[model samples]
Target chain A: MIIAIPVEQKDPDACVSSTFGRSGYFLLFDSQTNDFHFLESTFATGQSAGIRAAQLMIDNHVGVLITNRCGENAMRLLSAGNIQVYQTIAGSARDNLERCLAGTLSRL
Target chain B: MKIAVLSGKGGTGKTFVSVNLAYIQDHAAYVDCDVEVPNGHLFLPMDRASFEPVDVMIPSVQTDRCNGCRACVDFCAFHALGYAGGQVIVFDNLCHNCGGCRLLCPQKAIIEHPYNIGSIRTGNFEHVHVVSGSLNPGQMQGSAIIRRMIAQTRPFPNQILDCSPGNSCHVVQGILEADMCILVTEPTVFGANDMRICIELLKLYNKPFGIVINKSLDTRNYIKTFCREQHIKVLAEIPLQPELAVLNANGQLAAKQPEYRRIFQKMLKNAHSLVAPQNL
Candidate 1:
């Protein structure tokens, strides 16, 4: 399954962005292959950025989303896509991914 | 002629000036374009009011014929559409009712639906016709409602458009149909500063406008100084009186009182000369 984490930077060690919609970059991690890549967020400063960000995750076939917080509209869209949202602890993108894989992170 | 009363800052008495101006005129229409929080009805209570719901077109997708095209989703500039779980979801609030999605839909799956954003209330207060727009709570289509109200009140020769605070798109809609504008402002540094933006907007639109200093404490104040420097005409000044405040707080029309009646009458006459100097 592919997990998406809104990150501050493209690097795996970048801190998870506090905001899901206006995040600068999204780190897409493939849990099965232990591989990952970064995708730049398009609607970071646009209107309804949350909805656009959620749509980006849906288009990329993201099965899980890990972030600090999610807006109501974006949450509804994410839920409609059947993507499980997990709450992330304060740490780097890779650390949150590791915790998510270990089943230690809680569902948001 | 339609005169829009506007102030860039809130609580500068846009409604106060508008209500009085409308009240003083014979066969005038009071248009409350501040739809988000319309309060002109408080002073000029409507009698036998008729309401009409304002609706905007929102697109709905028929998933069966959508074909997973993603055309509508990508076409929306407002990002009001989202595709997930092989289905498209429409965020009604974010949609500006542009109808581009419905037009661009290749599969004929997208259809426009009427969504009620607000209502327009029209009634009579003695000789003055009152038309106020009330936007539904959490709705962001004040501009659309203002436009509709302006169109409806076209037959009335004299109009006082009470604009919402600031130079937002909402204010732009309010001033669009107006022949002249009356900028009501308070005598303060902040009030004078904010009024500059509204002046700039009027200049950009090339609309003739004058200023009315509300809540004035003295002859020499911030608003007066700024207006002099800009060479803008000061139409009238409403004194900062405790009795006026009390009467206004109780939803009483200041123009109804004998003393304040002359003030509004003169203000209206000055505002008339702004657009029609020949009549002066």
Candidate 2:
């Protein structure tokens, strides 16, 4: 399973981005392999950035998304993809991902 | 000839000028391109002639025909189309109705559907033919209605387009169709600053425009000085009259007063000469 967290930087300690669609980068963590990778967000230029960001997550096979807020359009798209979006925990990507993995984060 | 009445700032009396000018002009058609809040109709004594819904194309996916190709999803710049879980979803609000998704769909699953955004109302406001486009509440697509409003103009020698405030795409749509523009502005610092942007935009578009100082209060001339410095003509100046506001609030044509009638008539003649000097 892949867990995606919107972050400002590629570092695991980077603070979780408050915005889901216009986030600078997305950190993807693979639960089985315990590996992580970063992908630059492509929806920054358009008004539909949120929808495009959700598509990016869907294409990358991200099973779960963690962010501060998600727009209604993006939320509907992600939910239709069978991806669970969770509100971020109190701190960085590392902390949020830990809470996500522990199944303690609130589902958005 | 089409004359557009515009202002970069709101509450500059663009509608007031447009409606009165249309009423004063002989055999003219008045088009209210301010779809967001079309108040021109309120000032006109118009009976509802016709109402037509204005619709824009929004991409709708035929789920059965979609093959999980994800082509449409990728083609949409607005990310309006989403493909996931072997299904496609169209986010109506995010969709710009560009029709790119439908055009690029390899499976032919994407179809363009009409989404009604607003309506156009046309009627006779006494002698002048009036047309106004009004967008539905909460609708963000004012440009679509403006385009429709311009297209719905009656064939007349003189057409007055009452443009919405600001320099947004909605205002540009109306400005583009006019032969000349009458920039109605107030004599104030904020109005001057906002008018500067509009002046720049008109210059960029290569559209010739004149200024109309509405509600001129103080004897000092700030708008006049700016116009002179910019080499733009002041077509007319409407004095600050409490009676005019009272008349306007009651949907009365203040231009009916002989003095204002002469002012608007002069404005019409000036605007005509600027638009078509050959005809003058």
Candidate 3:
């Protein structure tokens, strides 16, 4: 499964963004391949940023999303795409990713 | 002459001034462009009002023919469309009804339909024709309704557009149809600050505008100082009287009273001189 987390920076050690929709970057971690990459959020400043950001995750085939918060419109789109959303703890993307893999993170 | 009355802050008496201005005119059209919560109709009671639904084109996709092309999904700038489960989903609230998605669909799967978001009510109140735009609850297309109402009232010789507050898109729609604008403001720090923003908007649009100081007190205030420094004419000063408040609260036009008639008449005269050349 591809797990996505809204991150403040490109690095895995970067802190998770408090906002799900307007985050600067998203860290995509693939559990099967043990590979990960950063995708820049292009819709951060535009209207309906949450819906566009959620569309980005859907287009990227992200199966799980870990974030601090989500909006109603974005949440609806994520659910329609069958992407599971999980709440992120107060830590770096790497730390959250570990907790996610260990099945300790709570669903949002 | 079409005059738009706007205020950056609410309760500065946009409707109060609009209804009274229309009341004093021999024949004028009063347009309530504040679709969200229109109150101008309350002050100007009309007889035998006619209503028409305001509709906008909303696009829907025929998924059987869509073929997961993603053309419509990518074309929507409002993010109202999304591709999921090998189909396109339309979020009605997010849609701005731009109609680009239907035209851009390669498979011809998208079709446009007229969706009613609001209605416009028109009636006659003595010499004045009253037109009020009311948006449906939870609808986000007040600007569209305002545009429709303005188009219908174009042939009228004189018009007073009661614009919604705060320099939003609704205000823009109302201001775009006016020959000049009257900014209603109060004598407070917050009121003056908001009036400054409205002044910038008028300057950007190159619309000739003057100020009306509502609820004025005996002492000099921020709005008076700001208007003096900016060289903006103070078209009228409505006194802060308890009687005026009582009349307004009772949905009465202050101009109907002998004491307040002169104030609106002077305001109309001043507004005319300010825009006479351009209007002619």
lDDT tens digits, residue span B151-235, model 1: 8888888899999999988999877788889998998878988899899999989888999999998668877888898889999
* First chain TM-score for all predictions: 0.98, 0.96, 0.99
TM-score of every candidate: 0.92, 0.89, 0.91
Docking class of predicted structure 3: medium
Clashing pairs in 2: none
Q: After superposition, how far is residue A11 of candidate 3 from its true place, in Å?
A: 5.2
Best candidate according to TM-score: 1
Choose the strongest candidate by lDDT. 3
The CA lDDT of each predicted structure is 0.90, 0.86, 0.91
- Between prediction 1 and prediction 3, which has the larger lDDT? 3
| Candidate 1 lDDT, A19-103, residue by residue in tens | 9999999999998898999999877988788998999899899999999999999999999999999999988998999999999
Error of 3 at A23 (Å): 2.7
The worst-scoring run of ten residues by lDDT in candidate 3 chain A lies at: A42-51
Name model 3 segments beyond 4 Å from true: A9-15, A89-95, A104-106, B67-69, B277-280
Candidate 3 structure quality by residue, lDDT tens digits, B136-206: 89777789999888888888888999999999989999788899899999987778889999999999899
Chain B TM-score list for all models: 0.94, 0.92, 0.96
Clashes of each: 0, 0, 0
